[model samples]
Target: MLSLFPQILFLAPLALTLLRVVLAIYLAYIAWYLLSRHAEIEHAELPIIGHARHGILWLSAISISAIAALLFIGAWTQVVAIFATVISLKQLVFYKRLKEILPFPPSTCILLLCISLTLIVSGAGGFAFDLPL
Candidate 1:
């Protein structure tokens, strides 16, 4: 088992990324639930930092896009992973602030969490691209 540890560590992020996708699907379903139940998710939400949530969402999109570009360029995975983790922390802040202002459904919370996690994992691409392709 100890010998398997290294292999497990190597594969961990990819597996985690796949799990994140599954969790995101579940969370999206919950978002759908909130909509169906006529909860706050259905209403217009409050502003964040004197601006709309769309700004945070845009930042999230850009963050993910940056991670993707780094992966495509075969950059250092650990370095990128660090950046992704930092961005995930920011995402957590956004989620917390959004929840305080608008009370998003549990599913939406899960989805955001999953997305942040997946980005962090995906950003660690094969210990920073082993193939040199």
Candidate 2:
């Protein structure tokens, strides 16, 4: 697989960007549906702010994803993709749900933190491999 690393390296950031988008979309829908529509009836667990927050989140995500793509293409210098990943992870952490301090349940905070931390670790690995000496 080391032999294919070049090709994979060329492709993986795009894949990561795609992963971020799909994951964000799914999470957004879950947050939105839970807080906006279902809460009145079934006691939705995610925060109401999370739904509205997603629009901004996804926008920032898109711009970051674009930068990641550019970094992948080698159009610019340094590990911009790593920077983008970190920024995205930080955004997730920023919006993490906390029922007492925030209006959202603790579960959402846990879930988002886990996801963001996983992404951060994954991004760190990618950066170590991707960066130039």
Candidate 3:
């Protein structure tokens, strides 16, 4: 499989971009759905934001969306990727309903973080708006 790395390097930028966009959209969608539809459901089990006000969820969603946008366009690729990876892990740790994300191993956040780390190491690839470092 290592031999295939160079073969698909050309597709890396696009793949990374799509990954960021999807993660962002999913985060925003989950936050929106939970906040708007289940505001009173009381997810008191969240490790990070359980004690915080509900507004924090909105802020997290908005921030994640913005970071996703940045990651999509390859702007500040390394920095944004790092930020995104950290946030993604945090979300995975705190967000309930793990089974809803994926029925199998390698949850969405894990896959996304791997992709983000690849972008960080390899840069944005040839098709990116911001060239790899």
Highest TM-score model number: 3
lDDT of 2: 0.44
Residue-wise lDDT of candidate 3 within 90-130, one digit each (tens)?
Answer: 65664564434322234766776677677677665444568
Give the winner by TM-score: 1 or 3.
3
Query: Per-residue lDDT for 93 in model 2?
Result: 60
Better of 2 and 3 by lDDT: 3
| C-alpha TM-scores of all predictions | 0.37, 0.33, 0.63
| lDDT of the structure predicted as candidate 3 | 0.60
Error of 1 at 91 (Å): 2.4
* Candidate 3 weakest ten by summed lDDT: 97-106
Q: Of the candidates numbered 2 and 3, which has the greater TM-score value?
A: 3
Cα lDDT, all candidates: 0.47, 0.44, 0.60
Q: Which 10 residues in a row give candidate 2 its minimum summed lDDT?
A: 124-133
Error of 2 at 44 (Å): 7.5
Q: Total clashes, candidate 3? A: 0
The digit string of per-residue lDDT tens for model 1 on 1-133 reads: 5774675677765664454444334434433433443433334353445433544445544555655455444455435545544543443556644554334554554555555555454553333343321
Clashing pairs in 2: none
